[model samples]
Target: MDFRFGDEDETFRAQARAWLADRLADDPAPDPRAWERALGRAGWIGLGWPGTDGRGYGNRCATLAQQVVWAEEYARCAAPARLGHIGENLLAPTLIAYGTEEQRRRFLPPVARGEELWCQGYSEPDAGSDLAGVRTAAVADGTGGYAVTGQKIWTSLARDADWCFVLARTEPGSTRHRGLSFLLVAMDQPGRIEVRPIRQMTGTSEFNEVFLDGARAAEVVGGEGNGWAVAMGLLALERGVSTLAQQIGFAAELEKVVSAAVASGAVGDPVVRAGLVRQWAELTTMRRHALRTLGATGDPGAPSVAKLLWGGWHRRLGELAVQVAGAAGAVGPGPWSPERPYELDEAQRLFLFSRADTIYGGSDEIQRNIIAERVLGLPREPG
Candidate 1:
């Protein structure tokens, strides 16, 4: 497949770059929410949604190449991380695909305008990679709605999310993958939902443990008892053009590792130098593979392959970072006051955070199983 961007795509890329530059020119340090709103106002948020919905920026009209160009440009500009990424990238696409007209009208606008944020509630304490093993219960109320009651762990951005799209077993005796429903639950409701932040080794709370105690969800996407399919579809969307953008970020991190090695005299070590060279080559090859697979249909093994590639690559890069830093990486930032304990420098933070790259989202073992069973026609693993 040709990877060249056509004239129109190039023009769109120029326009996107200029807009981002102008938006960031003055503040140099604008608030993330404000930047997101600017993107929303500039009609850059819902690139793949339909224009008639008034939420999309006519991005659906653009070719896949244009989308890739925009994503690469966004990462290249070093803009603020998007606060609405979950809504725009994962939930919105899922809704557009399986949601009813009412559901679309209700949820897509706030997301398109960057006024709302969403978190996923698919993983449980026992159900990380085995998503079909979700046991969060969502029983039907006497009314048309359902009352959700369960706990979800490793929920990213739960503390800041305005809503959560949850996968819960809706039927009483439901087994794995059956009788499940995707329910949209509001996070701001009083007394029903609770979010406890999970402080990572990096000393940040991006992930959380969320508890739902009779929380209400009147909006169920893709009908009841069909959440497994909808959830799988959303997982597939997770490996879109965003992966290319992520590779750009990986390139930046790799550069930092190289720079640290050079500054700390680690580059003079032949083994360290060889490892850095190998990392650079692998990153380049990963980017090429991503570009090659950009517009392919949803192959069952594709997302798993992409996840396995980047997860392991990033974890290794983190290790290389510490090796480059040598003894300095062993120390914490400053003397570690009581008020600010566990503070870490850039290399330290990368080393700690990237350790989870292979575990979160999906594990390496799970990805291998997906490739074997789905792509290679191997027998399913005995449960």
Candidate 2:
């Protein structure tokens, strides 16, 4: 496949780069919430979403390549990591595919305007890799709404999100993937919803453990009992154009590792140089894979392959980062304290966080199973 960008794509890149540069200057806002609204106002929030109904949901519709361009330029600009990405990339696409027209009108505009944020409620303590094993239950309340109850672990941005898209077993006794429903619930349900941040070794709580006790879910997408399909579709979107942007960010991180190697004179070692070279080459391969598979919906294994590649590559990059940093990389910046226990530098943070890169978004084991069973037509491993 020709990975070259067309004229239209390059034009998009220029526009995105200029806008990102302008907004990211002066370190616009300390918190990303304000920046999200800024992106919405600038019409950069939902580039990949389809045009609205005549009532105007208010998002730009771009070609697949153009969406990739916007993401690339956003990363290249090093703009503050988007807080609205969960809504823009994952929920928006899922709603377009499965949500009702009324749901679209009500939800899409706020997301387009970046006024509300969303968190995914798929993974639980036992359902992290095996999502079909989720035990979260959403019982009907006789008002067309449901009361969601269960815990979701590793929910990124749960504390800040105004909403959560939860997958729960709508039918009691439903096991594995059956009888599930995808429900959208408000986050501010007093006494019903609680978000506890999971402090990682990085001394950060980007991921949280969310508890739902009789939380109200007003909207169900793809109808009740059809959540598995909807959730799978959303996961596909997770690994699609968004992965391209992630690769761009990875490129930036890789550059930092390379620069650290040079500064520490670790680039002179043949093994370190070989590792760096390997990372660069693999990144290129991943880029080409992304370009070639942009809209290839026929291949079920594409997303799994993508998850495997980036997850492992990021973890390895973290290892290379610490290695290139020499012995000094292992230490914290200042003396440990109760408030700032993990006062680590950039390399240590990367190393700690990257450990979960392979675990969070479907582990290496799951991806290989998908490839073997779905793509290669191999028999399923005996349970």
Candidate 3:
């Protein structure tokens, strides 16, 4: 594979880098919703959408390489983490692939405009890693829509989202992957949907527990009983273009860790220095692998491999962050109380969040099983 960025890609990269530098130099708003709209208006939102969506929805259909360039530049400039990414990268693409023309027309424009935010309702209290085990049910409401009821756990952006793409059982007596559906639900149904934030040990509520008591699913994508495929496809996207952006963020974290090591004089230890060098080398490898597999949709193993690579790498980096910080990284800034808890510093937050890097999205064990059984054609593990 050619590693070089073509002239056009370089041009796009320059534009992306310049725009990010200018916009990210100062905080425009504390809220990321405003930032999402700004990106939408600039035609920077859906960088990899298919061309000529032509209705002038304002989505820029850049090439795969350009997409990578934009993601890298976006992270390099330390731009605020995108809140619309779930909509633009996952839901929008899934809709384009499997949704009706009306659904696309209704949905894509708002996402491109960043007028809405979306959260995923895939994992349930009982279903998580075993995605097919979802117990959430969606029954026809006798109108054009269906009423969704059940619970979704670890739902990112649930409180702040304007919509949620839910995976639910549509048919009675359905089990596992059968009779499932990909549902598009608006989050504004008052008195029906409830979002209770799950506070993390890091003193943040980035995840939530969502209760849907007859919440309405206004649209269904990929038809009824085909949700497994759609959900897997979305997961594949999660492992694709977004992985590159994640790596860029990982790179930034690594840089900060190194800087912290230097400032703390931990670089004097040969072991610490060696660990840092190993991390740099592994990150470089991951970047190249992501580039090579960026467009390799036929390679079923790529996504799992990418997940495993970054998951373990990030967990180790968290350990190194604490190690390099010596004893100081473990302490909090102030006394803790129910009304006022301790604040986590950058390294502490990194360490705490990274602890789940191997668990969420897909666990490390699950990824290995996927690679082994699906990619290597090995016998399935014993139950």
Candidate 4:
């Protein structure tokens, strides 16, 4: 468990840090798309994707540790939140793994260049955690593609996305995980797709409900009726080096919580002080576990374990944040008018947003079930 970065990795880190510093130096409020394009042009977007060109860093082929270094440096620099993460981190890898050559050529470039954006269409109103229970239907449209019809809730960044990778029941009588197909649907087709923002407690709509009525899939990845495997594979990718970068961001948030506690004198309270200490220690342990599991193969339990640890830890951190804020946490934005009304502060937004940390990706209960059934070989829960 050597945590130190090798010499090459350190060199990569220094390069990444310098590039980010130079890019972020000029524009204090750079447009997200512009920033993403800058990163993409600089060949910093897809570190793990194959195929090297003059436009990409893919030529060098970064190792997992190198990817981790870039991720850490990116977070440490507080660069603009990635606008192409769904495309680069999640969908691109899945595409490389399961997509055809044509599909790869068509989709991978935009993602690598940060020119196109993607949103996942997996969770539905009735099938949030139970992905096997997805009811979105994608029937053959007489042509080669399928006509998708259903609603997807909790779709992150759906409003601004150019495309959506959806899990739909391609078979008429399909139930549970069976008969599912992974369909890539265009989001701009007028009258076929709709996106409604889901306003959160934080007064922002980072998530949305997307409705597809006779929407057309551009193509199906991993073949028709084999979506369950593809979807599961994508989920596994969700637990990759990005998790290390995410932990870096979490460390930032935890620092804010501690700083808030100190500024508000909550650190004087023994219980609050102890909670901060425990949180710091747990975050360190989580990072070690994440690093250790980087090269693990064929372990069904790793992703679930990672999810369970981070989800609960984040939820607890949120509670601690609000607790440290004390009475001030109870107050939210004031009424708005023409000019300015109300806005949530950093701590308030953290408390509100982190409320969904345990529920969104996969519920705590679901993660437990996965760990039990797959990892420990325990009996499956009776439906």
Top model number, TM-score: 2
Model 4 lDDT tens row, 67-90: 899999988878778778898888
Best by lDDT: 2
- Give all TM-scores, in the order shown: 0.96, 0.96, 0.95, 0.95
* Per-residue accuracy of model 1 over 1-383 as CA lDDT, tens digit each: 56887788889999989987987788767887777777777777777676445545323455678778878899988888878889989999899889987788888877877788999999999999888889899988988899999999999888878999999999999899899999999999899999999987787888899999999997899999999999999998899899999999999999989998998899999999999999999999888888887778868998899999999999899899989989878988677778778678888888889998898888999999989999999999997
lDDT (tens digit, per residue) of candidate 2 on 1-383 = 45677898888888888887776676855478888888889888787566444444787767777887888887777778778989998999999999988898899999999899999999999999999999999999999999999999999889889999999999999899899999999999999999998888887779899999999999999999999999999998888777888898899899999998998899999999999999999999999998898888778999999889899999999999999988888778899778776588888888889998888888899999999999899999998
Model 2's TM-score against the true structure: 0.96
* Cα lDDT computed for each candidate against the true fold: 0.87, 0.89, 0.88, 0.88
1-383, model 3: which lDDT tens digit per residue?
56668999999998998887777767644478888898989999887676344544458778888988888788776678789989988898898778888888888889998898999999998898889999999999988789999999999888889999999999989998899999999999999999999988987889999999999999889998899999998888787777888888898899999999999899999999999999999999999998887778667789999989999999999999989999888788777888776877788888889999998999989999999999999999996
**Model 1 accuracy (lDDT, Cα):** 0.87
- Residue 276 in model 3: lDDT: 99
Model 4, residue 237: what's the lDDT?
84
Quote model 3's TM-score: 0.95
In Å, residue 208's CA in model 2 sits off its true spot by: 0.7
Model 3 misplaced regions, further than 4 Å: 26-30, 51-56, 335-338
Look at candidate 3 and give me any clashing residue pairs.
none
Candidate with the larger lDDT of 2 and 4: 2
Error of 3 at 373 (Å): 1.0
Model 1 Cα shift for residue 263 (angstroms): 2.1
Error of 4 at 115 (Å): 0.6
